[model samples]
Target: MKINWKLKLGSRKFWALIAGVATSILAAGGAGDDTTLKVTGIIGAVGSCVVYMLAEAYTDAGNSGGSESKDSAAE
Candidate 1:
């Protein structure tokens, strides 16, 4: 049976999402007093890595496609 995740999560996920957003606000405001800077730094690092990997993959695919076209043209 396929369960509807949105219906199952409902308000629980909604509240949790809200709390997460609020926590981010506090961290951005520099009010954590504990792990604010560390949390933000970790998030930034992970985001940057994800973007870098995606860009590299796309560029490699494009390069491979161009090489194939050049080979076909020369044949």
Candidate 2:
């Protein structure tokens, strides 16, 4: 069986992982207060949504025979 790591970026699990990492970074930075945690959660949610949208757009473009590259979009 072969695994494609790139495809995982479009998964909710990957987004949740990103959110978890963001939460950990915030805690480590001494911003573990309730308000800060809420703000971090909001930011993580927004970030994940943006990533998902971009991934969807990329997939759509590819399916349409467009030559859009993820690297270029990231920049």
Top TM-score: which candidate number? 1
- The sequence of per-residue lDDT tens digits that candidate 2 reaches over residues 1-75 is 887665675576776777788778878888857856797678677767767787888888787664446556777
RMSD of 1: 9.4
Q: After superposition, how far is residue 18 of candidate 1 from its true place, in Å?
A: 13
What is the Cα-based lDDT of residue 47 in candidate 1?
50
lDDT of 1 at 40: 52
Each model's TM-score?
Answer: 0.60, 0.46
Residue 16 of model 2 has an lDDT of: 78
Q: Taking the tens digit of each residue's C-alpha lDDT, what string does model 1 give over 3-74?
A: 864344343444445456756897777786567556555555555555566667768999999999999999
Give candidate 2 regions above 4 Å deviation: 1-32, 66-75
Residue pairs with colliding backbones in model 2 are none
lDDT of each: 0.64, 0.73
